[model samples]
Target: MRFLRQSMIGVFLAAVSLGLLVYAAYVVQSAVQARLSDDAPAPPPRERVFAVHLERAEARTITPVMETFGEISSRRTLELRAAVAGRVTALHENFEDAGRVTQGEVLVRIDPSEMQAAVDRLSADLADAEAEIRDARRARDLAGAEQTAAEHQVSLREKAYNRQLDLAGRGVGSTAAVETAELQAAAARATVLARRQDVARAEARVDQAATRLLRQRIALTEARRTLADTAIEAPFSGTLSDTSVVEGRLVSANERLADLIDPNDLEVSFQVSTAQYARLLNPEGGLIDTRVLARLDVAGVDAQATGSLSRVSAGAGDGQTGRRVFARLTHASGFRPGDFVTLEIEEQPLPDVISLPASALGSDSTVLVNGEDNRLEVLAVTLLRRQGDQVLVRGEGLEGRDVVTTRTPLLGPGVSIRVLRQEAVVSAGVPDMLELSEERRARLVAFVKGTEHMPAETKERVLAQLAEREVPAQMVARIESRMGG
Candidate 1:
């Protein structure tokens, strides 16, 4: 009976402990549920105080271009060399380093004494030659008179010989007398023949004298030309470069004195990778004439020059990865040869694509589509080209779609991004200062607001960019002024 009572007490105690444990578990469950209900995300704090930077879509023509590098060079590069050996007597006042000059301007004058002396000697010889010509004419006239007299004498002797022969044959006179008459006629004929020979000799002498005079005249003319070369004249209007010649400097014939360059005909030379060159080649396999731009880093002097592709080297250079190209600059002010510069040449424009900031495109081709949580969306885009500070993307929905103008490099696919100052970013992002359109404006605004969470300040900047984006006809006119039909 005592053992049964102890067992009952132990069983009662265990049942009470189990009931206490169940009650404690129910209380902890109630506390956890209340805590979860209290923490339910706080209702996504709405930052309507600061306006998000937004912009509308725009309808404007955008030129798709390719960019390349190049160097400045002058088209007219002349090596001023001495045409004749002489001491440089004078250099023009404009013959200084980088000095401008005019065509036909005498840049240098050699000591013309020797050339002048040669001219004088030639002139004297030419005069002597002329006098000899006159003498030759006089001699020719005398020979003509002698020749006429010899002809008449020969005629008379022939008649006399005929008479003597007849008399001897008829026996009308003594044989000795006829023989003597014949001998007399023969002697007369001999005399005429000797006189004719003298006349022929005189004619030949006249011709010799005339030929000598002609040769002398030619020598004189050559001397005169040499004398003129003593003074060096500028071939064209240009600037003088590498001018190391000084007055009184001895310059030998064919010696390099200096160089002349025409800045008006300036060119930009550059090298392009083989792939780039191939892209620029036309269908005929020749280099295409592409538009080019040059940027100079002069303080307050961001001047730009226009150019066209001239040619590319036929063969690749040794160990060079790209082909060499030359472009002719239309307006080349403040440009000089050997000036280290970077050129952004406009290559062929790609079609069926739109341009946007790299930041806007998310990783794996994802992009922010709509409403605040940065609705991550994917775009079926064909990446065409990448220019400095710009990218050309093409796709079915890309043309009319508003893309993020600028973004941080860290932006990736599915990553959240708050669009700030969309319109302002686009205008400020490129070399050109232009505004956005209504369509692009709305697109930009929607893109910015769609961010899951955006800072108030960022939203305001984005909105301000949208406001700046104006599809003003005035701005269009300004852009048109730079282009032509």
Candidate 2:
């Protein structure tokens, strides 16, 4: 009975311990659930916005420039030709290609032996003709004297015949004597007529001799002219090109010998679309004298010259579109024919136009301007002109507004934007001169000098710049790039 009572006491103790453990577990679970039910710390406040570059739109008059490329050519070019066929015997000291020649300078001489011989022969013929003329005059004078003597004899015979007739009538002379006298008179008359015929023949010979002398003189003149043509003279001062003649070479008449080009009188010939061509004309349908800047980039050196629009081609070339125009360069010292150059032509000034970066414009002629609350607003703009990286636009109510200078896919109308920095808008003007170091200047000068094809004036200009303490940095960079340095 005592053991049974002890076992019940142990069971009661175990049950109490188990019940306490269950109550403690429930209390811990309630605390854990309450901790999780509390609201978590809110995320940091975030706003979405696009960062972009911004520029202001200002109303101003802008002169738009149309850029094109063309080849330089001389305003006057002559193809030197051989006027007479002969073997080349002589050439001037400066008669080679690229040789400079002055007007009236003799450049070549053909073999004059043949021409000289012909002239000499003609001269001899002329002298012979003159001698014949003199001889014919003498003959004519002798004929006149003979005719006079024959007429005197005829008169004497006539008087004798008359005497014989009178004697016959008076019965003192015989009829045979009278008849003889009459026949003698008739014979004398015939002799006078023959003398007259001889005089006429002599006069005809004189005339023939005179005509022959004239013909000989004309032939001699022509021969002398041919002789002079053997020497080819420069018609004007210019540089020689495309020379094919050499000493001992036989050339035919009218064959091209060389080309002479007046490099000073250079004009740039370029073609432009019909629309651009129309803009270049005036109200009277004539091309306006628009200012043009021609630039030739050679080995990173810029040979620039100013010019004016001169004229346009009367008709379009075969298989060619657009009108061909020419610009007469002024002070084109370093320019040459066949030089491909860049031409910048100034157009009429556009008034009250806004200039913006080209990237700011959308393909549909719309731009994103920051409107109220710094939000982007799509604005339609008229693209007046595009100059390099910038565009001239005409938009209503666009002045004094900040326009986004760069476009991105993320940017659109009504999208909030944060301008990183406000850019100062300036006009696109001439490129600034660069400053270079002495070493760079020397290098550029050497390179310019080493270029054999560069014109003298261009070399001089480059050298002058190199002589300065500072050279254009852009020019140096260009030269270095080409030098592969």
* Candidate maximizing TM-score: 2
Q: What is the lDDT of residue 11 in candidate 1?
A: 96
lDDT string for model 2 (10-95, tens) is: 99999999999999999999999999999999999886899898888999998889999999999889999998999999998888
Off by over 4 Å in 1: 1-63, 184-196, 284-290, 356-382, 393-485
10 residues in a row with least lDDT, candidate 1: 48-57
Write down the lDDT of every candidate, Cα atoms only: 0.70, 0.90
The residue ranges of model 2 lying beyond 4 angstroms of the native Cα positions read 1-47, 127-217, 419-445
Instruction: Give TM-scores for every candidate, taking all chains together and pairing residue i with residue i.
Output: 0.64, 0.74
Name the lDDT value of residue 202 in candidate 1: 73
lDDT of candidate 1 over 264-368, digit per residue (tens): 888888888887788887899887777788765331123468878888877778888788988888866656677656677666655445566665555555443
What TM-score would candidate 1 get against the native?
Answer: 0.64
Number of the predicted model whose lDDT against the real structure is largest: 2
The 10-residue segment with the lowest total lDDT in model 2 = 423-432
